[model samples]
Target: MVRAFKNTLIIFSSLLFCFAQQEDSLKVGLQSLKKIESDVIIISAEVRSGNLNPTAYRFSVFPRHRPSEVYISRMFFPGDSLQVVLPENILDADSLANIASLEPVGGSFEKSYKLFSKQSDVIDLGIFDVKKKSDIVKLSVVDGQTGSPVLKPTIKIFQLGKVLYQTVLDSSGYGRLRIPIDRNREIPLYALIDTDGRYPLWRGSIEVSQGVSSITLALNSMSLMIGESLFRVRSDLTPFRKGPENGSEILFMLSKDDHIVISRSAGNKLYGRVRLDLHTKKSSNFFHGWIRTKDVEYLETFATDTNHD
Candidate 1:
């Protein structure tokens, strides 16, 4: 009985020893993982619009050496200042050259960053602005038919399928875009006007170079050619101006129910021929003039069945 007791105690000691060894091994493994698995880095992202908040945001870090191993980060907000642990392989000396950030705004945006070259761990992605004089691209918008300035049209510039700059035309019908100087000219810089589909889309491209270069975009006429008629929906009498703006000379007056046919556009104004009476079965006399878009409503009829009524 004494020998049997001694044997049982020996087995218990052996089991305890095994458990202790496993516990030590686990501790060592965790320490190694914490030390060598990821590199701690800080990133600060700012929105393009200084005062506006971003919708949803995520940033992606891509290593030049291992293109397949893209590390997409967690949710980020505008003006976010946070630390993130990226894969340690990105620290490899060979991998340091071509790291970049994909879509810092969480939408269709592509910006590159050299992760390894950053002496400090912090990366600040501030508002997109023209950092260098060589990066500025001057753009002008005008009417395709009349050669007048086209105002308030949205412009988007893209390079290699990535958006570089986007803004709306100012009162002067001009927008300044910041783009990297393309030395090779292999990638054509493209621009699109009226991206919202409210008007006919106008596209243009240029072989980009260093320093300021100007491009003129002409928008097609918005005027009704013939037989097309649009109803005026303004509740009160609207003035028809000799020019596009409200301060221009008033050519005539139109009622809410007048039938008008557009002929051309000046800035946001539509130049059209309008009938004096919308309810008249007989042909009515029509007048020609410009009307502001804000004062009237027009139907967007892409495809209509003439016999449906």
Candidate 2:
């Protein structure tokens, strides 16, 4: 009987020991895992590389909810450690409908971060200010470090949520984006560029600084061909600027002679929209430009910021 008791105790103890070992092993494995997230006036998302290469890559931050899909595609890199800026207005959060506190990662890429020769923290939106002859969008970027300006890496602009203008900067590291304002204002403008991964180095919301003096509407440059109609906003207080460019009836005859200036652009090719001046209430004219390889090249080559390069 005693021998039987001893055998039973030994079996029980062995089982307990094996279980404890497994628990300890699980704890160690958990410790090896890393978690990165934050709340408040900031966002830190894991950068997943859907696709990558020496010249370009596809990347994005998650919470993709809509037709936008909101991703970074075709990110050009010079190859280096990159620094990115969180757009001041991008703290967009929504109360979850009791979805899990944290969304479980479906899957992830191999590398946590990447390095490139040319990385950017500053956002240089390539645009032409056609608003007033002197229209300008003044933007400042803070490096991953203190509020210093990183002088490398080029900034590209994606309007209406995609790239339309792109320019390289000079030694000063300042990029001048001229809306040259002659496009559709119906859609909101979204800026994007990769700092290191496949996402914007910097993104933000900007508007014409308070008065007419900040920007000038270049009326003389307005050339309406193909019966493009220019529309004028009835009011300046509201962001809604309606006219032909804003999706109104195109009165080709009335729009031809009207001189409209470029306000902002949202996209490229047939998918793009341009916001024009608000002065032409009677016309339906807006921007219709070609953004081929040559157009992209012209903008990049003529970039005012390239003096240093």
Which number leads on lDDT? Answer: 1
Q: What are the root-mean-square deviations of the candidates from the true structure over C-alphas?
A: 17.4, 23.3
**Per-model tally of clashing residue pairs:** 6, 44
Over 181-282, each residue of candidate 2 has an lDDT whose tens digit, in order, gives 444555555543333321113333445432232311111122223323333212212222234244543322212112222223444311122334333322
Report the lDDT of model 2 for residue 79.
38
lDDT of 2 at 130: 15
183-228: candidate 1 lDDT, tens digit per residue: 3356677777772323345555755556677767666523454444
Give stretches of model 1 more than 4 Å off.
Answer: 36-44, 51-54, 64-69, 73-75, 79-83, 91-96, 102-309
What's model 1's TM-score?
A: 0.35
Model 2 misses residue 247 by how many Å? 44
Q: Using Cα atoms with residue i matched to residue i, what is each candidate's TM-score against the true structure? A: 0.35, 0.23
Give the poorly placed runs of model 2, Cα more than 4 Å off. 1-134, 196-200, 208-309
